[model samples]
Target: MAWFSDAYHFEKSQLTVAHVTDCHLFKDQSGEYFGVNTAEYFARCLAAIAEHQVDCVVFGGDLTQDHSRDSYQLFAKLIADSPLLCPVFWLPGNHDELQEYHAIAGPHILSHKRITFQGGQLLLANSKGATPAGWVKQAHLEELSKGVDDTPSVVFCHHNPLPINGYLDKHLLENGPQLLNALVNTHHCIALFHGHVHHDYKYAFRGLNIYATPASSIQFTKQTTQWQQEDLGPAFRLITLNFDDTHSVQLTTDVVWLNG
Candidate 1:
């Protein structure tokens, strides 16, 4: 429940961040999951991200499929060998084990949980609890509440704080209402980002924008009552935060598909 503060000043008018999630990587590069070659797709997504010139990269979780030490090692190696060239921060998704991920990506881990860029801050909280579903601990909520200040901020977590309907809703954050209530009271949070649904989604709740990025390996069929895969290729999100003269921040997000 400690907040790690890493602050940086950017001269640019806007800060560019690449959001990649749900990699579901395996130890073997050739291993496939749900008919998708996750390692291959993740590599392609990383290549796409390299071209963006992002200031930083934020991983929205589900970093592994097998939850093995090798899986975490492979992920760390891929990122180390990639050309993204920026600070990478990651949170654990439902499919990920924190200890295993932290053991490998210790330096790059998002456990410190907050990053400052220009006039805005990106606050990441762990929503993974004792179950596959999401739950925000009271300590995390208190940390978030205390972290808010005059700067505009966006929160990132592994689970959707709000339901997306169908099968996904069943596993949505059980205490999402409490989380939302805490956020709404902050008055400085502009948006929220999450993974796990494996599909792209955008909505507004209590005046805060809620975004869900597609999985880097596979996408789930939307509006389905049961588990099903979508035919869509892997994708990632590029988010740009612009600051006005009043220090008000505006965000624009674009989902990039790696089909080629």
Candidate 2:
């Protein structure tokens, strides 16, 4: 609805990004899906976001257990109650329905989008498709390459392009190599961010930073080909970006654990 209000105070020259992922929120807090209180956990994560107070918030998809329209409405209302400076940006995960999300979030909720903020650019690529794992279709790749063609950019999506050290990696973006190739060949992306791994991880891909934020509901421990679920509590990533003409860009990622 583009409800701009004095409540949203933002500094035009710089931006702070808060990233939360894999909420898997449900309608009922007591509803146990995979043995986690999805709704309560998501509420706690939202509270954490309210406390951090960043310029913009990014939800790395799988926002709901199932792609329910009611779920999206609930999410919109939850975020609307927050006083964040910038509008929330959403990327679809394997669990989201792109059409429903667009209907709920608005026309701006495209599968992929290029956003400019504080002299820097962000390219959000949609990885939602019919694939059981992940898919970066040709059209989205082309669109992403175009967005990063000559700008310093950070990429966002739902699937990790790098190895996650588990069976889940099998569902990793099947076409990640092609996507990364497009990014590297285009010379525009400085970093790539994603979810679905449900853990905090960082790796270097073709000289670009590839990072994954932990789930906001529950975290999965890192193991070598082993699946271990832990009550690591809810987590989020608060990232501050500093840019200047003479100095290399500076970035910091802080893990914030929700208390409750």
Candidate 3:
């Protein structure tokens, strides 16, 4: 898990985005684990975001602990109840069901399309259905490759294209090379964001910035001898983009402690 300060610089723009992922929301109101309620922690995380004024929100994936319609309903309601005025963009997680999530979460969830017309271009690609690992379809890649201009483009998905030093590293996108091969070939994209490792990570690949946000509920210690979820600290990310004919991006780490 790694975090970088002032990761990138962009032109001045009022557009700000909050990135939250892997909520793993559950149906039980008790929000309990081993008979102890965990709902308080969930509430705390949501409440903490009220302090930030963002133009949009991006949920990277893993929206439910159990892939149930009820869980998606709760997640939808949670967003509706928030005081945020920003639009939301969602990508699927390994835990999410595409048909059910789209039915319940509405049209904000993205897949194989360019979603924004203002500030810059935001693209959401589907990479959740690959076996042995996640994948980006060739047709989708072809569309995505041509979608953005020299303007800064931020793409979101559920699978990480880069490998981290841990258990999940092996489970990364099965066709990452193909996807990245297209991305680099495009020469217009600024960064790629995703979730699934439940850890904060960023790596530069051939000039493209690839990043993954930590889980909002819990974080897993990476490259450890034994697999365990530790409080690397619950957190989110803030992305502000500045663009024109050419583009640049800035990412800030927002850490929200469950105790507060």
lDDT of 1 by residue, 113-177 (tens): 67776678888788887888999888878988777756688888889888787477878888987
Q: Which pairs, if any, clash in model 1?
A: none
| Model 2 Cα shift for residue 157 (angstroms) | 1.0
Which is superior by lDDT, 2 or 3?
A: 2
Runs in model 3 lying further than 4 Å from the true structure? 1-13, 32-40, 106-113, 117-119, 244-260
Which RMSD does model 3 reach against the true structure? 6.4
Per-residue accuracy of model 3 over 75-176 as CA lDDT, tens digit each: 777766766555566777777777766676454333324545445566777788646368877777776776654645778877888777876776788787
Worst 10 residues of 1 by lDDT: 1-10
Ranking of candidates on TM-score, top first: 1, 2, 3
Candidate 1 — what's its lDDT? 0.82
Total backbone clashes of candidate 2, pairs 3 or more residues apart or in separate chains: 0
Pick the TM-score winner: 1
On TM-score, the stronger of 2 and 3 is: 2
Kindly give the stretch of ten consecutive residues in candidate 3 with the minimal lDDT sum. Answer: 1-10
Q: What C-alpha lDDT values do all the predictions have?
A: 0.82, 0.72, 0.67
Worst 10 residues of 2 by lDDT: 1-10
- Could you tell me every candidate's TM-score relative to the true structure? 0.94, 0.87, 0.82
